[model samples]
Target chain A: MSNAGLDSAYDVAAVRQDFPILDKPLPGGMPLVYLDNGATVQKPRSVIEKLVECYENYNANVHRGIHSLGDQVTTELEAAREKVRALLGADEVEEILFTSGTTMSINLVANAWGRKFLRAGDELLLNEMEHHANLVPWQQIAHERGAKLRFIPLTADGRLDLTALDDVLTDRTKLVAVTAMSNVLGTINPIGEIAARAHARGALVLVDAAQSVPHGLVNVNDPRVDFFAFSGHKVYGPTGIGVLYGRRKILEAMDPFLCGGNMIRRVRKESSDFAELPSKFEAGTIPIAQAIGLGAAIDYVQGLGFEAIAAHEHQLTARAFDQLQQIPGLQIVGPGLAHRGSIVSFTVEGVHPHDMAELLDRKGVAVRAGHHCTMPLHEWLGVTATTRASFALYNTHAEIDALCEAIQYARQVFRRK
Target chain B: MSDDLYDDYILDHYESPYHRGHLEQPTIAHEDDNPLCGDRVHLELLVDEHDRIKEAWFDGHGCAISQASASILMKDIEGKTLDELRDFQAKQMLDLLKVRLTAARQKCGLLSFKVLKTMVYTLDERKGAMSPTQGGRG
Candidate 1:
């Protein structure tokens, strides 16, 4: 229960207490079984409280507000920016720009970065496992710019096939946009090495860390990634808040994605220049409460410590993989790497993923089914869909056991008919 | 919490479903999916020479509400004509769910019925003898 103890060890019961919504009841007299953390995690009381406190105590506009309440809110906003900067290990707070989650963040890069530099006959490298957020924007940009879009193929084990990197990373390669960890397969890519390769080719690297940040450690400084984007909601924070971290020098050199009030340095009727590194990217009125809540969520995560969380989730994932293997015909996807965080996706013979999810739901066990927004990967693996059980800090071995039993029950139920 | 929303009979059929596979000479076949959740159901209709649904078979994979709704629908319009099947309303699907479905789950519950109706409408377009091989799903 102590903070020091929590920072070093795995304690599910203690961690579960932090999330009040997890104890709520459902319609069928079932306790809430939230295994859809990959979509959006349940926020802790700390995050909720921080949001409420910000709204009640310091409700005012940030940056341009000169009044008392505005000053208070602006100070809190800057503090939140600092927290995000530390979370990502960026050089300074100016590098972290708040956006309305990953979609907007990606769009900002596509509009500002893609629109400016990429040209016709140039190529942008992408992997098969990218979420639609990462793929579509780049594709649209490529279509407009008349640039060629190339794919870095996936391996049989579901990891990015870097063997073809030599071919993929051509001199004309403008950018390499890839996911650090796939939301569907939970496979962690070698972002550091991939960034190095792309950088050697004079191409920038944009990492989709939406799935990776919540599960394990992420240090943009260590990886030396050019641009990193992730959503707060996926990491136990409130929705409508995300971060876009660009290297300081790179951000300063790039044009503003949006031209508006706060992001402007000085506005004459005729002409104006944009603000510094982050404010230049963040144009409109920001999600103040959500940003403060995300700051709290980051603090909560750091307090729990990534090493301990990883160790705990590692144990639970190993147990889940082993238990699922014991089942007769279930096939676990991805590399089964022990270092990867606890995201297990699989399928059982003769049982459709949706049917399996339903049976599991009946047993008060929750699991996500279907393509998980990575349809191309599913197509590559020759499965229409798969059931995914993604674990969080509060998830327990007991939950994995329950999931296994429910899946077995599903097999038996379908088999009987 | 309405009994009409999640009837025990519906849940019973979901847990121990009936007529859950391909039918012999299925007159009409339909498949539908929830793009968000990836839930899907396939409805197979066995119609007689009189253009009446003589037998109704439901198959494919989905959640309890969707599968049960499909089962309950098969039971409701088993002996009805295409007109009666088409006349089937959203309220009937809600009544079959045995509990009020949210806006999202409501679509999951109604998709099978919609797809089946579409299939029946499409079937009327064929001029020649409808081959049994044509009855097979995509």
Candidate 2:
């Protein structure tokens, strides 16, 4: 059970005890082998307890009321923002804006920033491996403003082919939006390098940290990064809450995404002035308890530290990659184990992904199948769908073994037909 | 017993589909795709002068459940009349699959039936063949 050369202080068995859901049994009395972390992570007892405490104690509107409950809620909410600020290694707390999740966070930038600065004939750069969340909003912006949308093509091995960066990052390109890590491929993109290249062309960069933020360290104040976004649910926090980090100067200059309630400074019929910094973008009553839960989740992850988490996850990925390669017809997608994150997307020959996922589910091995919201990437890779088994801090080598066994069983069952 | 949703018979139909091609000239044709899973089906019917389906064929790519369901549907409606096809319900198609499906997979199992119903409905609308009540089955 001990991962050699890793930080041995980080005991995964102790970590698994924190998450109550990991102990629950699936149908047929089989132990649940949850390998679907790329979709969303299971919450720990600390996050759940924090959410319940917030609701049971100080359940009130934040930032508006002067009452004791309101004050308590507002304090906790701002404290949550500070937690996110620290999590991202952001320079100032004012740079963090709370939203629903990663989808809304990207939409906020596309609407508030892209609409204002991008002009007709200007280009919006994106990667082929972007989730629908990061692609659709820009697609809408391009349609509305008569702007052009370009993609940084993927190499044969699924990494971003940056050889054409000089031609792609033209002066006409206003923004370079890319994922820090691909959710499907598990390819950890060179965000710092991409940001540096884009910034040299006077273009801003938006990092979709939905997958990367939860797995490892992220410093948003890297000068090259202008906007960064991630979700709470994917990081073992409660749903309905996420964070969007923007550079202070850029956020101060842009318009608000939503025009209502707390986001407005003064409203008189037609003309209105927006609030400053974070509140300028936060419209209406935000996810109060969810935000507090996110704060507790951050505390939990930080307690474990990224170094331990990364070491453990890398071990799991390498074990999985080696075992999966032993299968006769299984084709592991994305980069090699060295460059890949914890996610492992693959396809078994002559077996549809849906069948494989269903068969695996019967064995209490939960995984995601199909396009994984990256249809363009699948098309580029010459696959309609792939079966993805992503890992988390709580997952064990035993669970990876179960996944491989279930996959082999699925292949056997399909081949019988 | 191991997830009967992928029964051997279903896999057999999936591996070798029945009537799985387009007619040279068809009286009615319809194609629909399930965007969620990328399952697509194209149902074509060649009707005779007596309003009977002389030939029926389906072509598409999907999961085993979907492809098998389409193959089963092609066998079910080969010689049936347009009226019989119009009155066909989704329950009948699910019955043919003979396996309980999750809500998401239910859509996959019934995609071919939906495409066929749509083709019949479109033909009814164009020719003013069936009334609203008669063409209400799907």
Candidate 3:
């Protein structure tokens, strides 16, 4: 799967056929050029069929029922867990716990682990480029425990100034939470290196893989990541289902965040015992159909192969960078294509992001605009908001060209004023 | 190139906003920010003894629709009484902008008017002024 042949073998047209939404037209009968993959990706037909199959056939609650449909659903749910484990290259299926989404996963760690372990004067190291999902949870824990929140500043080119890592990670540092890929700047952080540095100082690392896991390879057993989390919707899977992969020992030691029915082992008159490993974290009846759909998504992505997906997205991003750079007043916010993921966020001088996004929408180019849930990062960059066009495997070079033309048209519309 | 959303007047006020500055020793002042998009608006109104708004100013950064609508609102509010400002509805701002916005963009276009309405309501609440009918304009 990691071979060079897979990279050259990518056929985007064939890939686009699997996603039915690619053929849909906009309100004005223009072909839709969806470039908002960072927010969420359109699901493939295989994934959609899997969801229908789950509901149309074996629609039952898992883990407790002894009936035939329940047994089948429980088996499917566990199989989905195994698929997620294999996706993260984890050793055991028990390490993967399904939550609602990435936000829930991070909050599980922050409350279950941080509230129990972190004390006053402790340091929680995070980067400035993190989405509010990653930043706010840590901020809450730090505030609750009287711990100090430290940041790894971004460089002039929108990269983590890792030169300050040594100063940031101290013996008092309890955890280091960072995004594997920035949602706004598109800069892919060196998670392994950051994890290694944090581990050397006896600090645990949590990688927010909501952006990277969908686009490239993410191995939970990489020795640097003690915990990892991602959303199903971001990875071309169904929404309302996400994964939190934690090392077994750490999960065994931490307290449960949500206490309810499915997560409890036994209940006494005044006391109760919690379930084991992953079940201890999964409180309610899980998102059964969504998890199965996520399994189908993982199968689709693995079938296409990570190497091919990365190569295809790299080509699209490179071409977009080249063409978008030619537009006057269009300043790209992140690093060059070499260090970025499939996202390209930029600002057009004298044009507001909302205006550009609206104009681009009229031309059937779907993009994202605003702070992108990274207000601190935008403030650090001295911009209120930026218009971002993020790519996926189903995207084509022609779509990139269309995006460039739409941007030029938006500039013309603004200049007319 | 005239889309229904961004007309010449909206772009003009966006490029050159009127009364976009701070007011000294204002009678009523408040600021609010849209954290989702980072659009902020700080408004100040100078009220005379007759309860007329002698001057109105706003300072913030946002999209063209917001800035332009704020500029239009600045011109509309000058020399009006506090009651008149309170009776100003969000629909009036939308009509003035002359654009049909999506549900999301509608928030951006009406943000300034909402901020001003909040400021006036706060003033009424503080001074025990304005009956329910006058202060209840949305």
Candidate 4:
């Protein structure tokens, strides 16, 4: 059933219609083939409309106002929380905490939880495949709390070397920080297997699902994820809104991140108590409309179904892999298509990644070129940068052809000189 | 004014860069990177007793624009005085490219020039540090 790929019933043309910006032309009347989905997906019309509707109708401060507008805004905001809870399959809605983005979400856990729980000799196990967002926060917390940072290492193909895990996951290991999928490598990690092993050794697991959640289903309870962080903008939603799903019991034990008005239960001149579950972590005025828009984005994705989206995206990825390979001097980084998601990052023999991106842009194909915020991963790959062509439901096979053509043109331009 | 940023001029410099390596006994050397894009440049200059740049070489790993900028700028500074090279502005290095750059791409084009400016001024900075003023080379 997990292999329910290439769903003939999945009509991608209809899906493209939902995202209006997909049809827009570039400056020279060339169609815009946006392949930067790994960074951020294009929002559906429903999400766009929901943002306007929030400001147009129920625009008020949540959880503090006495007016009807406040009631409506508060209700919508909580409703969005419920949707996020459902999306990640958390046991309770309050287990979900609203954050600015994945960076902040991970920082919340590192500071609030790590500072309290981690001992001096404790180790936080990480791997080379993790984004800077995942690695840097742990580095900071580990240094602050006098804990050690250990690496699990990666296989030659860029998958986590689980065989090396037994040696690394020791009794002193406090946490295993990993990404659900590599934003640069496109490798989908085995979170369930990693989590089970971590638990056996008394280490908690935190999954950075910024790349995974948008492309596939992630049930927090199934693998029994202790902490999961993801950005809303990456999942066809608005920017400035993200989710941090920690187990309710774990959340209750941790200190509140970003303290002030909303997160407090009672305030005195000297000391004060923090509020309960969700509110305790949420400080300051939240990104009100973005949360609501994220709810709509969740609804829009759920309406299409993960099975269908996966099937469609799988077809695109497989096709892109086959096509991108035939090009003479181009080598796609990461594992084979079976081990990866819809992202395809590659490097040409002579053409640099930045130069490749510029030439692709000339042909109206928008691709990301850089280390994709995984500098360590690039270091491991022995390259400075790679051009990434990441896909979504709206991307077509024809767009893949356009990508190949532009790449060929780029090769010619660099090869001749 | 060219339609393409990586034209023959830029690509030629990138593909077959002139004076692209380290010197055996360089008088001055410096290196830096564009943290945003991971582009990097390392420059080595041999200065003669006349206080002129007798020869210059650059080694870098980056896009066509940045690396070509290194090659082009190094070629221009081969026989120039140390003060003349020091007086060289970012606009002159940019004009050497003969291509229009966006704000972001401007950083790529001028990265080598930045290294050159830093290299030429390191002596003055070191001297200033020795003098010990309220403000040294910030």
Candidate 5:
């Protein structure tokens, strides 16, 4: 799956057919149109079936029993860990840890890594366009540890304000955490470059790939990111499962986030020793069934090919950007921010985002509205909220046309009044 | 209107909320904003001689649930007194929407009631300051 050859290999219709939820109808006798891929993607049949198969056949608590079911379950679970390792190009499967989602993963790093490393007067660098999950955790950590937190400003078009990077990334900066692709603006930051800068400054980089992993091909190996986190639900898998990819050495050095049964290797009267690399991070019962579903989802994504999906989404995004711009007063926000992802956010003059979304919904066009958990970004744009229509690989050109028609209809309805 | 998570009534009100924007001389004003969703509402209450609401108006912007809940709230409490408005609960409105809301959305759905509760308390305090005999238009 070379990047250059993916355009021809990808088939949009075939990809869409695998997701059964796409063919359904809504309460208003209109076809269900889902354009909220940045929030979460609907699971495909293969992923769903695999999840049910695990529960129906090999239904047992893993890692504790000598029965055949336990062994089978444990083996498959470990195999899934290997799949994720290969997907991210990690050096070892031991670097990947399962958590509830990206939020929890970041929390783990902040609590374990930040709590240990951060000293008084140290600095944490965050970007203005981060989802609240990424922003709040670090803010809390910085506040608790007496470490000052600063933000990498957004460019006028909503990309990272790189001109001021030299001023922000100072000697005091201990961490630089940013989103790979913004959930709101769809602006893809130059994360590899950012990581290089952070490393040069003797700081660690944490990439929030919750939006990027689903739409684009990400390799943790390339830029040498210290840690990266993403949610399974956003990547066409079930909820309650997420991946936190950390450098093996860094993860080993950090303390365990939670001390529970599985996380401990041995316990003495007054002291206890922790388990190995990945197990130390995962405490208590993991989302066993959800992880299996995630493995199936990764297989489904690989079958379609990550490069193909990226190209397909890029094509769809180009079409959507052009088509949406044709609608009167629809202003595309954050245009061309370092190879933007599939999420496209916009505002319509004289028409509230809430109103725009409703009008689109009446015509069977689904789009997300509001600040999209990026209030600082919206506030910077001088708006309370905006309407967003994000695309997935399953989305087709016809659906983009349908969305355009719906927007045109909405404009007419608003204009006539 | 389709089977998507969005509700038509919610969508309808979001598109064309009854009394959107600012209200001058807002009798009992209460404002709230959901920082997560960027939803905001400013509710106004105008009570009559009988201590019942003579007119109820709302102005602000938000997602479908917040806007629709405001519109529905205006309709639900138009003729009720502050005491009666306190009896208003979100469960009845949830039943009316007839759509299952996720945990996050359940909070969005009940925002109007939350607004009303806060607004009614403020109104009650204002009324308590005024004499019972001072009920007519000034």
Candidate 6:
């Protein structure tokens, strides 16, 4: 594929056109000013049409069917896996396992690897800012395996207290699970540094890239990274399909997570053997069309290049900070713009997040409001909830202005008597 | 998508709620939250010898709709019999707000109703009258 972004100037209008939903007028006639990218991004036309194409043609079960359509579907399926493997810079396609989403991917490791290795006193290092997807699975597995959960304290600014890494990364720490970017705080963590520290203590690192992978470049082959997980929907791909890249040696040694028809290598009435690296985990007829759509999404993101995506998103984040902070009572949470991604979570002095979100929605700007699945982080921030306006490559500076305007409107409505 | 969602009437109740503080020596009380958005409601009622509401007060933090719902609920429940309070429905609360709400926002509008329902139900159970206390939820 050609370097589409490298060869030309980054055009927001062109990027917006690629995603049909971005320009569409809402039912009330206002233009859609979608800033909920941190939750699930708007899909480009290519990914949408690719899903339609996959369903229209070669609509058959993969791997088992001897018919022509079956072979075609199987080829497309494996090709999609290969695309994901390459996207993550893994050593082989076999190392990439397609699950339902990042939640399922993390659960697989927690069950397959965690259940096998965790002893009663063994510790799992996590942080307060982690999304529920990263925090919950480890909590479940730790509870089941009689393991202890240790949190890496956050600095008052909401960034992880890396200075205290030595305090938590002890020999008993079996796994260090963390999000590459704070979904609530927008803090970009130093994953490579964290991994190095954890590895020194013989603990494996699992990167929850659900928020990070979609906005920037990520290579699972980073030697310090033992496993990486992300959802396709968050990256402008179809929902119900996600990726889990595990170290080859680690995956080969662990027992399978799910058991069923397509995941077996051979079966006897009394005994059965499991399939290979990916098939061992993919039990039923997988999300065939969604996986292919995810491939298209990878191609779409690759064509845009992460450098352009990051630069554009940083501009949006900066605009939001400059304008949002200027709002009399608004306090932006998480780290400052220099240390974050495109996400900006904040709370107005007088308005609640739910009210803020509703008022913003009235202006056709869709932002998420709540604890954002990080109750601990919200508690640490000493607020019940915060309004988040997360950006993507297709977002414009005008959208940031609209967000600020909506906040002003909300403030006026909630101003003291 | 209309600013009318939080218009003058709703904002009026939100800014200067009629019963926005705690009540002392309340006969019935309950506290609950909308886990979906962390919106909470604490409703307290002081009842007379004949099971009629003498006073109603509320304490909580949340969106305008929920807070306003409680503020108005305090007005509607005063001097109301426990039976009448039990008969109060989620739709009535929305109707009182004078605003259109989607299903999700309806939860915010009904948060006070939820706390009030629980408080009344617990009272009914104590009185051996557990016949589905509150009307249909929003």
Best by lDDT: 4
**Cα deviation of B130, candidate 4, in Å:** 9.6
Give the per-residue lDDT of model 1 (tens digit) for A1-417. Answer: 222232328567778899998877777887766677788888899999999899899998887777999999988889988999888888888889999998888889988988888889999999888988999999899999999999998888888888989988999998999998888888889998899999999999999999889876578978799999999999889999999998887788788988887788899999998887778888889898899889999999989998888787777788888899989889998886643567889988867787687678887878888888887777788777889999888877667777887888888776633
Q: Tens digits of per-residue lDDT for model 2 on B1-138?
A: 234887777888888889998899999888998887888888888988777888889998878888889999988888898898888888888888888888889999999989988888787776654457566444
lDDT of 4 by residue, A1-417 (tens): 122234544677777888889888887899898999998999999999999999999999999999999999999999999999888888899999999999999999999999899889999999998999999999998999899999988999989999989999999998999999999989999999999999999999999999999887578998898999999999999999999999999999998879987999999999999999899999999899999999999999899898878888888899899999999988999999889999999999888999899899999999999999899899999999999999997888888888999999999888732
DockQ of 4: 0.80
DockQ-sorted candidate list, best first: 4, 3, 6, 2, 5, 1
Q: Which candidate tops TM-score? A: 4
lDDT of 1 at A162: 88
lDDT per residue (tens digit) for residues A221-243 in model 2: 76459999999999989999988
lDDT of 3 by residue, A1-417 (tens): 122223444677777788888887766899889999999999999999999999999999999888999999999999999999998999889999999999999999999999999999999999889999999999999999999999987889999999988888899999999999999989998887888888989999999999998787589877448899999999989999999999999999999999888899998989999999789999989899999999999999999998888888888898899999999989999897778999999999888898899899999999999999998898899998999999998888788889999999998888832
TM-score, model 6, chain B versus true chain B: 0.88
lDDT (Cα, 0-100) at B82 in candidate 1: 73
TM-score-superior candidate, 3 or 6: 6
TM per candidate:
0.84, 0.95, 0.94, 0.96, 0.84, 0.94
List per-prediction Cα lDDT, in the order shown: 0.82, 0.89, 0.89, 0.90, 0.82, 0.88
**Which consecutive 10 residues in model 2 chain B have the weakest lDDT in total?**
B129-138
What docking tier does model 3 reach? medium
Superposed model 2: Cα runs more than 4 Å off: A1-9, B1-3, B129-138
Q: Indicate the TM-score of model 3.
A: 0.94
CAPRI-style class, candidate 1: acceptable
Off by over 4 Å in 4: A1-7, B1-3, B125-138
lDDT score for residue A417 of model 5: 32
Model 3, position A315, has a per-residue lDDT of: 83
After best superposition, candidate 1 residue A122: deviation in angstroms? 1.5
Report, for all candidates in order, the number of backbone clashes. Answer: 7, 0, 0, 0, 5, 0
**Residue range with the least summed lDDT across 10 consecutive positions in model 3 chain A:** A1-10
Show pairs that collide, candidate 4. none
Q: What does candidate 5's lDDT look like per residue over A1-417, in tens digits?
A: 122323545666666678998878888788777898888899999999989999998877777879999998998888888988888988999999999999999999999999999999999999879988898889899999999989887778788988899899999999999999888888888888898999999999999999999975568988789899999999989999999999988999999998887888998989989999888998898999899899999999998898888878888788888888777778888857346989888887656676678788888888998888877778888889898999887887778888888877766655523
Better of 5 and 6 by DockQ: 6
